[model samples]
Target chain A: MRYLLIYDITHDGTRSKVADVCLDYGLNRIQYSAFLGELSPAHQRELLLKVHQRLGKHGANIQLFPLDEKAWVGRKSIEREERQNNE
Target chain B: MRYLLIYDITHDGTRSKVADVCLDYGLNRIQYSAFLGELSPAHQRELLLKVHQRLGKHGANIQLFPLDEKAWVGRKSIEREERQNNE
Candidate 1:
């Protein structure tokens, strides 16, 4: 299933680490702190655990929203130009 | 229908304006540039049109994703603390 992942971490290092985890799971970064892509249910749980462990005791917010294929395609995005820096 | 609204605008003024539209529609801001809430399909289209108009020729990106109630509840979030500044 496809999932939309959103996170806000105060620390830069931890933020990038979470981004790395998202990339490792084959998710595409849609924004500086957001990712969207397909992942198995098991992998989704694993990713959540990884982020939870990294965020333990630290003040950060991470949310995972699973979307079915139809719902994923139903998303609407408008862009005039691509961001030069994907990071 | 629950919708996730995400946007990235180069100009701070435009970004805030887009956020205002979200709030005007009774959507809850979930991050610096994201909002989540329930809306009727007609209102959803209205919100999209508003965002699109506000974003015209400004090189901004806005995305809207509709989620069913089950999918909305299926989301998981972790936060150590609430942000002092809602804006």
Candidate 2:
């Protein structure tokens, strides 16, 4: 299952730690605070638990969103051309 | 159906125009390059065409991903605490 992970943490130390954890799980960084990857339900739960441990009592919030195959087709992205159009 | 829109454009003018179009469709900005909202299939297709029109021959890419109800509940987010934790 494809998943989107978005997070907001108070501590810089913990925030980067979360990023590393997500990368360790093979999730791609879509944005500074967002990541995307394919993981099993069990894997997803495991990552959540690990993130929770890092969060500790800092009161940070982290969210995981599942994106099914149908949703995958619905994704859109735009890449700009290298050359500029004067017109 | 919930949808996520992600885009990259060469021109600032076209980029902001796209953002306005997304807002007109009632989508929320989840990030600088991403927007989220619920749209019907027809509406989804309609928005796609409008976005395409805006692109013209500039070679910008825009993608729309459909997110179902099952996927919505799978969303996760974190909010930081207001107070400092000395401990």
Candidate 3:
């Protein structure tokens, strides 16, 4: 199944760590704090647990939205040129 | 259909304007730079146009993803406490 993961963490270190965890799970970084990709149900739960542990009362917000085939197909987007720094 | 919209805008004024546009389209603010809600296909197109116009070579990045029923139903999330300032 496909999934969209996004987060908000003010602390640079914690944010980077969470991002690394997402990458370790093979998720593609779509934005600085957003990721999208495939994962099995078990892996999804595992990822959630891993992310929860990473958060560790850091007062961050992370959401993982599972996308079925239909959702993946129905997705739409509008993107413009972004500065290299922001990208 | 459900949709997820996220953006990164450097200019404070531009960012606020873009955020207003998203809210006008009935998307609820999920994160500082993310919004989620239902939108018809036509409205989605209209929103893209409006947002595209708002960006207007400002070098901002905005993406709107339409979610199908299955995707919306299968979504997963992990949110920890957020600071009042960030909220």
Candidate 4:
């Protein structure tokens, strides 16, 4: 299965740690605060737990969404390669 | 079908306008720069065009993803309700 994880963390430290956790789970950072990649159902649940633990008592918002192939393949994006920080 | 629209626009004006467009299209602002809601495939295409027009070569990154019922229903979220702005 595939998952799309997006987050908004006010604390810089917490945000960085969260991003690291996502990478450890093999998720790619698709946007400044968004990650997308493949994961087994079990891994997905485990990842959420880890994220929840890190987000403890922090000001943040995170959402993890499961995306099937049909939905993933149908995604549309517009980006500017020249932008230094696309975020 | 359900769509997840997320973007990173540096230009405050452009970002604000884009948010307005999403609201006009009957989308809910799920996060600071992310919107989600139901829309027909045709409407999805049109929405993208409108967002593109608003970008107007600005340094922005936008992605629109189609998510079916299973995926949408499987979404997991963790938020701090007290946060002034859950961006």
| Per-candidate clash tally | 0, 13, 0, 0
Residues A9-80 of candidate 4 have per-residue lDDT tens digits of: 888888999999999999999888899999998898889899888876677889999998888889999897
Q: Against the hidden reference, what TM-scores do the models get?
A: 0.87, 0.69, 0.87, 0.89
Per-residue alpha-carbon lDDT of candidate 1 for residues B1-87, written as tens digits (9 for 90 to 100): 788988778777778878999999999998877899998989998988898777645678777888877678789888777335543
What DockQ class does candidate 4 belong to? medium
Consecutive 10-residue window with the lowest summed lDDT within model 3 chain A: A78-87
Candidate 3 Cα outliers beyond 4 Å, as residue runs:
A82-87, B82-87
lDDT of each: 0.82, 0.76, 0.81, 0.87
Q: Over all chains combined, what TM-score does candidate 3 have? A: 0.87
Query: Which residue pairs collide in model 4, if any?
Result: none
Complex DockQ, candidate 1: 0.47
Candidate 1, CAPRI quality class derived from DockQ: acceptable
Q: Top model by DockQ, which number? A: 4
Candidate 3 clashing pairs, residues 3+ apart or interchain: none
lDDT of 2: 0.76
How well is each residue in B4-35 modelled by candidate 4, as lDDT tens digits?
99988888998998999899899999888799
Candidate 1 residue B74 C-alpha distance from true site, Å: 1.6
Question: How far off is residue B13 in model 4, in Å?
Answer: 1.5
